[model samples]
Target chain A: MGGKFSIERVNEYLWEIPAEGDMRVPARIYADRNSIDFLLEESRNKEWNALAQIRNVARLKGIQMAALAMADIHPGYGFPIGGVGAFDLEEGIVTLAGVGFDINCGVRSMVVSIPKGDIEKRKEELARELFESIPAGLGSTGSLRLNFDEIDRVLTEGALFSLKRGYGTAEDLEYIEEGGRIAGANPSNVSLHAKKRQLKQVGTLGSGNHYLEVQYVDEVFYEEAARVFGLSEGSVVISIHTGSRALGHQIGTDYQKVLRKASQRYDIPVYERELVGAPIKSQEGKDYISAVRAGINCGFANRQVIAGLVRKVFARVFSTGENDIRTVYEVGHNNLKVEKHTIDGVEKELLVHRKGATRAFGPGRREVPEKYRDVGHPVLVGGTMGTFSYILTGTAKGMKDTFGSAVHGAGRVKSRKQARKGLSGEKVIEELARKGITVMAHSNKGVSEEAPDAYKDVEQVVNIMEGAGINRRVVRLRPVICIKG
Target chain B: MNRNGHETLEHTADMGVRGWGENIETAFKEAALAMIGLMAELDRLRIKRRIKLECSEPELEDLLVEFLNRLLSQIDLEELVCVDINVITIERLGGNYCLKATAGCIKREEVKERLLVEVKAATYYGARVVLLESGIWEAVCVVDI
Candidate 1:
């Protein structure tokens, strides 16, 4: 990573590493001058070199346009987190690193129509209720204990399964990405072990950075777009951050071995050990994709169930109707999808891999909800337990360049070890409380490990994307209460 | 970080676990302990249940990952918090290396108040299994959290 490279400054907010030996396409990154310096420093220090990972992704077969990384780029296993790689559907490859272990790990935000002051008055009780009602932490299990067959239904029906069980309202589906269900998901492709892992984990939030936060709109950058998305300054909102639990983990484990073998069988170059994949047409590839889709569904169903629980808690605590909270939006960060994007003005379907990144379909896309069609859907950006999160919307320019992708969050600056050095859970809670944020966490070590100091500045990360004209800010949210697993 | 036994290494986003001993079996067992340490406060887990585990891979590096993933699956299935491992054998079976072991695991409820983080999987990235010139066999890998 430190030796040599063919990188050129394309603009103030963009850089391009042209295709060299074995690289099929150029690698593009959206970052300001300072962020670029930080990324290079990571390589120079031999920390996680996201720039090198992006370069390796450019080596993938049939990769469309250019391998890309958002401003929040950080080192991941093979593909850099906040990495985006799209490839021709017919000639592409499906890889484990592209999607990561927590398939469809995402954020779901709901607008809570209540006075922020009233909620703050009882913040301690609300935080405790949420932490208790929602099962969280390592190996936490939920109330819904489904058998194998029902797990399959959960995979195929997605949020519908949760809705049928009276976990959520029917109207909720309309606001979710893909209507909360992915059609190509075939449950048969999912392993029995994976289903077993999910039997009691459907609605549970797993540990390590996953959280349920109560926040309020702190500022609005674009008034018109904010109105369309139901955001008003000082309005309350709740965001759930989690994904398919052990089911997704098991699926990733099972598929990585299969795809690793497939890579050897198909003579696909193994750029990295975890970067192994198979041709899209291969049986192994098709099965892995189907399983991944099922994993995506598991993520939607999980959030739906958790959202229902959150709504019930709010209704009970504030003495208001559950319907008072409306779905703002739901989107996955780590995922794989087939979407049509124009390259050189030739619109065609391509397999898009967004790992630690989220889809930000621009205005006028049929996939976006009708009401927000003119202004594009909201891209929820989660900040740390003590920082400001933002709601961003895609732009036509974003679609043209990044295939409408945006950074997931403030990328990590320190390791878990470094973050928790001499830090304790009680100390973290005290720090957050000093900032007027309430935290309820199951693990003190986890609280310390995910301390705000571990992450890069989210506001700076979001501004880079806004400066790049790829994603525009709508509203900023400040955390009031956080329930961490 | 102790190289003679088991210790956790630091990675940017995940846990880097390593274990070593005079032989491969002990190294594999110590490695499992290092991974378990990342999930739970080991000394707090009291109740124990015995179970058998086995895994096979083409190379020792991969065998280490397979062995760790199998432990993860057991944790999900049995709500386990493993305290000790008895690696009965690490034999070369046919063209592949196979590891078989018996583990004493406590239910997660036993350490309900002391759990740390959920490990997603053991990854092949940055994984290694080496028999050092000092005659100590060491197994190392990064576990996705």
Candidate 2:
């Protein structure tokens, strides 16, 4: 419980945990009053609270600035789901838990020329076709069966490998974060077991909150930004939510042991064993970063392949050309990146870790693609299966306050079991059907567990982000067909 | 010592599994079973093949994590949908703890029950191994989905 910690309100949308105990800096949280109240109630019931995790992160060596939690903050393994922290490149450390097991787990959205009315007419058929074309659920394998050498290429090349193999075109890579590939990826640093697990799972959509949804732009909040991103009212789009599959999971498992040992060798104090970290300059740290970058590449490749499959399904179902479907942008939520930022009037390169949070680089930032340089990066916030998603743009406030990070999604409020107590999968599907939304899932229990009521109201979450001045809403998407794993 | 059994614990985002037994070996086996149960109904799984695994760690908690992660890796790499630990042995060798086990594996095609969730990995968060006053061994851990 959070009874042992002292919390003070900094503003309407921000809260602070003063530097105390082992904390080297203050911990900041961006949330609405209601959300803060919910967090207080959650802390009383949950053994591991998000606030404590934030405080624990502040105690990490060489951490620059404060540990920040976004509007959708929730308790997670070592770092809260919406946790963000930046560490000094020379003296800071990297923790496997801070980046999460599903490394670079992110969202990619594509806008099509089709209208909402047309999509609604063939919603059921489209959902079925998508389910058939794209593999989903546990232990699912894709069409590609690469050997050890080929797997290494994927680890190093990322989406570029998929593009070269004709899964997608070269233009698709332009909008992806880091051009769909991260630097310093070394397949040699990755374990053989991790490569083996990723052999046939390259294009899979692993289950548990991962999904592919067909949605329509119901409203535009920022007209200019929406136009620049090619999003318009009544236009249909497809969003793929997943991560690096078993490849990333294996990397975390492999490096967790290394970091645990490195933490001791470096004499870094670990509040939670899961938060074990190693100095960036240490051998263990270099190995972990190289392997994680590979995992990030795997994630980018997986989403690119899935996007290609979605395009294929759309071309067949709607009888449109492949070129008609174009990618808007792709952003990873769970990742660690080395970026230059001004801290106390000094430009320093810091390794920023964003877990269950998305990078929202503001306008004029070099990281922002040339096309979006004047508007800012597009941030995709996926809601639940039966709810509405939002597209927002980065703000200068976010860059200065939280390193340009935004909430990833509507964080879970209820446990999966609690959501499935009396609800049946058939009832959920029926309810969504009544609301004119088509639902297709591999398992009925999966549908019941992802019921819309299980999560916080995404509208409120996005509102909090807007009020906090971190991200400005550009458009709102209403789901027409949801394909769940 | 208590009887060998396993139970699912509630977590906000993911889920947890707890297993207890008279010995650490039984506890490990039950913990594996508990995790598999979360994925699919185990009663309907057929034991098609046998897999041998061995790993060692300095701490009991780390050993449990390694053992469970090994089973999870086998499930993904070998396309296993269901599995059961047939025999498990835990021993202390000098400064390290060693674990050896044989698992009964079932392929995806063999599973008849509805698949639930794909557990990503066993995390160190909230992981624990303790001896109760009744002399029973208990292992509790959370798995990322």
Candidate 3:
């Protein structure tokens, strides 16, 4: 199978997989030489291969250009994690695999006025406060329990619903993607079972790689960009990484059945059963798009509520005004968005599906918030529990190349079980504490699974994006307090 | 190695459950139990309630996914963790494969503190249900977290 696929180096930072067999378009990968070598090595084995999954995406109907994979590309259920693709509105199809099961799973960063030195002194207390305030781990329930009507409003209104309920201020909405509300969300497209699952799960950080971290800007790469994005060396910030929870999961489960049937009815050939999709104009496709948008809203609202909770903790812990803590940006990695992009010298509407990838719209794009319109949207890239996360800005070159997208985080290098074998949660906690970082988790098993060595070097991942000119580095954030599920 | 049992398999980001038994029905039951164990400590959960599930699909693979997803839905709706599964019947009906099973669930409160990981949905990736030449039945699949 590896021999069947030939990859040609287009440049130092790009590789191309030419169209072959049933593939309608070629596939391009953005990675440095080392990352490409790692991928090639992985391709040698017959197990779930990322390159093959990328090609399978190319075979999907009405794929506008080529399938794209970021430097963090890894084998996922259907679409490779860190994969991106766009489909023609009139001819392309939508698949549940593209958006992923955890719909709109994303990262949001908030800047605080406190300095790094002050946070370092209170890291332990802050970690404890955040861990207790934020419900985490498997089946963790939050304070909010919505009924049928309230759930419908959450599906439709998104973060605005949370705002109306006094979770956060109106200003927070401006920094959120889609103003914290994805339009065309139809609660009717969501099932009652899905709603029931989300009734008590909102604002909770579900397990497995989801976390809340208190960090400080350790290094400023592009000083001007950092200034414009409200960052300074040694300033403290908080990052929340989570998604739509059970609601999004149920939506994916419900739609997989519909799209599988749609594939059969429309006579669409599925290379992998998980890659099944229906034509974008077909009834199944429309319904899925609506339901996914509703799921996206659920994510926005969840993060918004969590952000409010974080602010409350910060105010109590640091004795700072809540108004001083402000959101820098909120962006979803697993999602599908209908956007206008220039293709072949023509601007066309395409449904862009980014799985384990983040949207990095360049400056002047209307989608970017007005305050930072001249500096481009901030791309929040979260690292593993003990590693350094980065903030990068979208580039015009990225808009021209990979549909204004960048790698979401440091891709995993090992399986959780393998990570747990060599690492102990208590040992990891002690090591971080020795380095002046506070760590808290509900389960030692969760901590062992999220060991820092399990992930690739995030600095290297970000450097590739910068080298490729897809995204510009802003600042690097090192964790002071980390909380895991 | 056991005649009917399940084991947790390693996946890079998520997790996998692989089960084996003497027949397909038992293999499916083992897979369901594996999924339950991954979510929480199944030993601590008591069978407080029982729910019957019936599903039919044209493909055996789809039937397996449906079976697991139905169990997941029951967990979310009832706010409970499944502890046991009893396959009453599994047979080919016309062109479709049909399954009827009873799932016993315990209230979430009983095992909330013991929960380890939350599985969102069972995916079709690398899914397989096969009868080996050794006359043993096997089923394997990955679940999203």
Best by lDDT: 1
Taking the tens digit of each residue's C-alpha lDDT, what string does model 3 give over A1-485? 45577899998888999998878999999888998888888878747778888989998999988999998888887899999999999999998889989999999899999877778777778888899999888778888989989999999899999888778778889999899999999999999989999999889998889999999998999888898888999888899999999999999999999998899999988888789889999999999999999999999999989988898888898888868888899999999999999987899999999999999998999999998899898999999898999999989889988889999999988887788897698998999888877888887777888889999899888888898899998999999888888
- Measured against the true two-chain complex, the DockQ scores of the candidates, in the order shown, are 0.81, 0.74, 0.70
List, in the given order, the native-contact fraction of each candidate: 0.79, 0.67, 0.67
Candidate 1 CAPRI level: high
lDDT of each model, Cα atoms only? 0.91, 0.88, 0.89
Give per-residue CA lDDT, model 1, range A300-337, as digits (tens).
99999999999888877987676788899999999999
Binned by DockQ into CAPRI classes (incorrect, acceptable, medium, high), candidate 2 is medium
The collision pairs in model 1 are none
Query: What is the model-wide C-alpha lDDT for candidate 1?
Result: 0.91
TM-score of chain B of each: 0.93, 0.93, 0.95
